[model samples]
Target: MKKFIYFIFGGVTFILGTIGIFLPILPTVPFYLASGFFWVRSSDQAYQFLLSNKWYQQYVTEWLVKRKMTVRQRIQILLILFVLLAIPFIAVPNTWMRLVLGCVFIGHCIFFIFFFDKKRTRQKISSENKIFFR
Candidate 1:
C-alpha cells in the first residue's frame, strides 16, 4: 500500500516535471520533488535514476540535500508565476471579483517572491526517511 502511493507520486511528478521542461508555466522542481519523495520510498533504482537524470536532479536534489536554490532558479520561478498570475486577470469576464482576485494574486505573488527562498524556505521540510534511508 505504501509502495503504491510512492509509485503514484513518482509517476505524477515525472510526468508533470517532463511537461514543465517544455512549458514554462509549469514548475519543474515541485513535480521532481514529488517524484523524488515517492521514488525514495518505493525503489532505490528509481530514486537513483531520478537523482542522476539529465535535468531533474539539478534543482530538485539541491533542495533535497542542501535545501538551497540557485539564484537563477528563483528568478525563473518568480518570472513564471508573475506571468501566470496575469493570465486569469486577462481572461476572466467578471469585473469586481476579478479585480479582487487580481489584487490578491498581485499581493500574493509579491509576498511570495519577496519572502520565499527558492533554495531553503520555498521547499517543503525534508523527510527523515529520505535522509536516513535514501
Candidate 2:
C-alpha cells in the first residue's frame, strides 16, 4: 500500500514537472526531483529507470551520485528561483505580506548558497554505487 501510494505520487509529480517544461509559472526540476524521491522509496525498478534516463537523470539521480549540481547549473537554478519568488514580493500590495515573501526569498537564497556544495570536477558515474573521478 505504501509502495503503491509512492508510485502514484511519483507519477503525478513527474507529470507536473513535464508540464512545467512548457509552462513558465510551473517549476520543472523540483517536481521531478520530488517524483524521483518518492519513486526511489517505492521501487528499485522505478529508481533504476529514472537513473538510466538521460533527460530525467539531471533532476535527481545525478544529484544523488554527485552530491551537488555543477556551478553553472546551480547558478542558473538559483537565479530562476529568485526571480520567480520575487514576483510575489514585487506584485503584492500588502506590506506585511511582502515582508513575509521577502523572508521566504531570503530563506531560499540561504538554502541554495549553503546547503549545496559546488561541484569542483566532473566525476565519472560508475556502474556501481560509488562515484569516481576520471
**TM-score, cand. 1 vs. native:** 0.59
lDDT of 1 by residue, 1-134 (tens): 98888887898889999898889877787888889889999989888989789787565655545555556766666667767766776787779867786787678667655455554453344555467677
> lDDT for every model?
0.74, 0.74
- Model 2: per-residue Cα lDDT over 46-95, one tens digit each: 87876676657765556655566677876776677778878877887889
Can you list the residue pairs that collide in candidate 2? none
Using Cα atoms with residue i matched to residue i, what is each candidate's TM-score against the true structure?
0.59, 0.62
> Where is model 2 more than 4 Å wrong at Cα?
1-9, 21-24, 37-44, 118-134
True-structure RMSD for candidate 1: 6.9
As for candidate 1, its clashing pairs are 68-119, 69-119
